[model samples]
Target: MEFGILSLIPPIIMLVLVLLTRQVLLSLGAGIVVGAFMLNSFDIVPSFNEIWKSFSQIFYVEGDLQLGSIQLLSFLILLGITTAFMTASGGSSAFGEWAIQRIRTRKGAQTMPGILGLIIFIDDYFNSLAVGQVARPLTDRYKVSRAKLAYIIDSTSAPITVVSPISSWGAYIIGLIGTIIAAQEITGYGELEAFLRMIPMNFYVFGSIFLVFLTIYRKFDIGAMRKHEEKAQNTGELVDPSKEVPGDLNNEFKATQGGKIYHLIIPILVLIVATVTTMFITGIQGTPAEEEVSILSIFANTNVNRSLFFGGLFAALSGLVLYMFLQGSKSSTGKVVLEGIKAMLPAIYILVLAWMIGTIIGSMGTGEYLADRVKEANISPTFLPFMMFIVAGFMAFATGTSWGTFGIMLPIAGEIAATLDVAMFLPSLAAVLAGSVFGDHCSPISDTTILSSTGAGSNHIDHVMTQLPYALIGALAASVGYVIFGFTTSTILSLVVTLVIVLVVVLLFQPKQNSIEK
Candidate 1:
């Protein structure tokens, strides 16, 4: 029963296979099968049986986990439908025309996704898919690399969610911290307060956001990204050299004769309003007013997956209605909606495989095993925050889920923090949050990463390769920043140093070139 180091084997195998093979589904499926074998104590028959059972349970079981997965899948399906409808109705074309008149340069093209990513802080899933669908046309017009568009979408999603106070990520984090505080018997500690204090210390998220702007403003591109961008500029190929994305994806949405920008604006507004209202209503459905008075409390308790499903459905329906009126033909509406859902089938498949692998790893206890190694190691209190950051990053990178990393590492970090100076608590907490995002950002197996690739229509491997360098730089800067925070216990000083490190590193490594123009 005690797998010990064997618990880590599945994730390690998955990571190796991904890097070597660049085949995500095969790699994930193989990793899950290997983990199943381990779970069945190396009995080939039972392992094979277990794999099928797990797959069935993941899709059909009447449990929260199964429901959650279904909710996510539904959201993705609806997102695809909404996007397709927007294109079919000529909403995307209208927006493209409007944006073209305003956005006249490469930086402007790049900035739009980043801005949208930041604005859509309700959920990273929504941010990733929506940004890609909305911005792909604009980026293509300027010949921005699909890799770069992916980078922008990827950078903004997890980082912004982790930092925003009213997102699904924020709620999950608060719940994790609350449980830790309760177990530690730490009195008078406010989860929201502690989270607020750690915001400035979340170096990687802040650094990544800042790096996005700095890279854009200074016309800076380095490493694989620089090469990809140059290729896009010179040859107008926005994807990697070896990849072949269908031109229909970019050109299929012919503009309607008189489609207005309102066609796009109305549905998106409805989606946002419906989501927020649903969250509040869901939050208040069962709780007494006295207990759930605060908006934060309401948000923290709401079923985010369900809300997302409903929101996406509403948005898709709204889009359908708009298209019906525009086309005045039910068959045209039905065909376009089906096309949108079909477009997302590949992404949905990847998502299902990723979740299956995550489930298998969870059963193997990959994250806890990694945490145990870190906890058992003799680490000093002063250096614990920095060390925890690395440990959390590795665990997340291997498992491809920062949420899983948080569930495993935060309790351990909280227990350790209780024994250290009071000032050390926030830095340790921030380290875990920042490092988890870092790992998720760089991980090829991460759902958000896959969504980013799907959204930008980039080759998944190419997106991973190009974005990894930027993520690493931000990680390195955050690691150094945590060390400074550990020593000084000054959030402001630590934050300033981290920003300086990121800016300096970016400027130093930047490729010198004339300002980019399409």
Candidate 2:
């Protein structure tokens, strides 16, 4: 059963097919079939049965209809319909027109998503989907390529969540740190302090954030991104004409003349408020009455899927009400609503396929095989963080799940550091966190990456190909910083040097371009 390196075949096959074919669903389906067959000893009937079970399990697990996947899908549907209402009512165009007057430049349009991505760090899912809806109009107006917008969204989502203790990601990571400390039983610091300490050592977090703005301000693109940006800026075509784009409703509904700016603002604000409020209520209700209720405890226990679903529901309702009020009862309210729902289908399809592939990869012991290889290697104490960064990066990229990588690698990193050198423990864990984000950013099948493209209305493959260069440089810089921290144990020195390296690399890789319009 321990397939070791053989388990790498399905994921590698998936990546190659995706890169060559540029068909996400087909690539994901092929990977799932291969992985399922491997899990079932390559038997024809059992392999297909396994695939069916995986697909069905998305709706029900443990003999109960699970809300986790269903709620997420509902939320996506609601988001789409809400946008449809906004478009039919002319709110989206009104807001874009309003923003264009004040924002003025392409840099200003690009700045909004990055800033919004940082501010909306409570959950990467909400941040990835919502920020794109809010900023896409402006970015399009300024001729910023959807690929670039997606890069910014992808950059800020997980990187910010992993670093912020107030976020869903932070709660999960802190809990893992607690387990690692208790399991190792040689801790001088508590979970919260260790989480704070690792923030600076998480060099990729800052490096990626800085690189996002650095690219925007410096006006440079790398690899395929240059072509996308130039095409957008020159011809005002925000997306690649040849490819399919998710969350693109531009051609579905036109903005009406009667719509007001507040129409767009109201639903978005409602969504944010409703989602946050639900998170608190659910988080509190889930905790036992006998236990203390605190911020971290609340976030740790919060039902993100349920909260996001309700939030989307309220937002959609608000948009619907606005449409009825502005467009009157005679207007085809159902049509606009349907268009919005239809707009999200492409993203939903891709998301569901990505989740299925993730499940099969899990069943095939892909992560375990990679982890076992890392365990067998006799890596030195000083190289612990460096090796962990590399291994975690690969694990996450192959599996397309950073959180999964964290679950598998954190405890292992703790044990390795515990045996090798206690001083390297936090650095090793930090490297795992940084490396996971870096790999996830690059992965074509990553959920956050897919949501980012959905949010940005970019072609999924275009986003993946464009973001790869920056992810590599960010990981390289973080790796260098981990090496330095392992040697000197100086957070300040390591962080400063890592950021400098990112800036230098960003500047050095300036794209060669034809005359792009200002």
Candidate 3:
């Protein structure tokens, strides 16, 4: 069935369906079916049989399904449970109350979300969900628009993850870089060291993060959502800021003050500590087996399953224990855990669907085909980073999945850089990561985008509508940065320059409108 031509069909059909229906899961599922059909194009009945085979391949390979579905499920479950616990323990509420008390100025309130986004850069999924979950109540308390919240959360998630060395992303990226080096039969450079070297060249990541901070500090608005933001500010009405919030609206303030601040903070701290301790014990730092362990290996190893889930679980447990000890009631602890899990349910469903679609795309060969085509184009060695960014952005935007984009582009980009004799591997890898993140940041159909909207409790369309302009601002800055690093100067210098430009531009162009009422 000419696999090349056949490969294009699924993505094309998926795109058409998505644009027409605006239903992500439906589009992805249809795409997967089409791909499977194409694989069995020679036989009608067999095509149907192949569809089941493909589905099973993704879900039941060697009885493991790679646990990809389960991991996503666990993440969602843990998110819900932890959120419930945090609320019940008064953690989320306490943080909000504290933020309200401390941030007296409007600009300060606007900037707070971005700041929090930066602090949680360890992983994109964690950053997306946690920042939104923790900051929504506070942002709402200050009458910040849900669109603004989504913008901040989405902006920070991918960019921060790309730059942070200790994140789930970092592990995947490092492994990929290592594989590329080994595949090309290159020697003399250690995997981690090579990655570290490339960080300076990863202009997009630094630029994006800079733009997010700039958006917050400068209050820039340039697109459809700008009107919404302005209207919200002028009317002083609470607009539905995020998609996660339900329509019931029985009480505006029920979840706002349900838990305490200490409950949230202590649990988060415990998670961090546990992650560090586990990393060291697991020897993720390329250290000797008998040597003293560094606190960084927990996430570096490939064997660790559900690390984020465990981290979330531990945090939730800590919150529960603290709640029980402080409130002195087992029933209270149970209620908190249950409620948190419930709050996280919607997000869980969305993530599961998103992951399934991503898995389907991989199984169908859509991602690989696209990657090979980009590679065949033979972009110039010097302009490779910028080109990689564009390719990644398109793939992620088209598919609405950053991780899938990375899975496709990273290997290709790495191999290209190796072919070009480029010594700095990290920056090239960082370019792929940055590009994937940029597209995901802006795409309405992206899972992270959905999760951010959910976490902010804003309307999904509203969040996408508002966040696009701001994301573009970051993307533009990042593109320029990528160009600089790829063609002209040092990566570190490019990062600094890009950051400055974005920050200034965003600050200079504040949105005209300021508030809205629900």
User: Which number leads on TM-score?
Assistant: 2
Where does the lowest 10-residue lDDT sum fall in candidate 1? 244-253
Residue pairs with backbone atoms closer than 3 Å in model 2 (clashes): none
Q: Which scores higher on lDDT, 1 or 2?
A: 2
Q: Write the per-residue lDDT of candidate 2 for residues 43-145, one digit (tens) a residue.
A: 9999999999889999998889978999999999999988887777888888999999999888999999999999999999999999998998799888899
**lDDT computed for candidate 1:** 0.81
Clashes of 2: 0
**What ranking of all candidate models by lDDT puts the best one first?**
2, 1, 3
Q: How well does candidate 2 score on lDDT at residue 225? A: 90
Candidate 1: where are CA atoms >4 Å away? Answer: 62-65, 187-189, 240-255, 286-290, 327-331, 514-518
Give per-residue lDDT, candidate 1, residue 172.
79
Clashes (backbone N, CA, C under 3 Å), per candidate, total 0, 0, 36
Order candidates by TM-score, high to low.
2, 1, 3
Q: CA shift at 132, candidate 3, in angstroms?
A: 2.5
Q: Give a tens-digit lDDT track for model 1, residues 1-518.
A: 77888888888887788789977777788888999999998899999887887777767766445787788888877877887777777777788788889999878999999999999897787788777877887888888889899899999999999988788789779878878778877776688887887788898999999988887777667777888888899888887555533112444445565677777877777777787788888876734666845666776777777877888899999988888788533236677777777777767777777777787888887787888888788777788789888998988888899888888888888888887655577678888998899999878779889888888878777788888988998988888888887788778888899899999987787677755553
Q: By how many angstroms RMSD does model 1 differ from the true structure? A: 2.6
| Global lDDT scores for all candidate models | 0.81, 0.90, 0.66
Model 3 lDDT-worst window of ten: 246-255
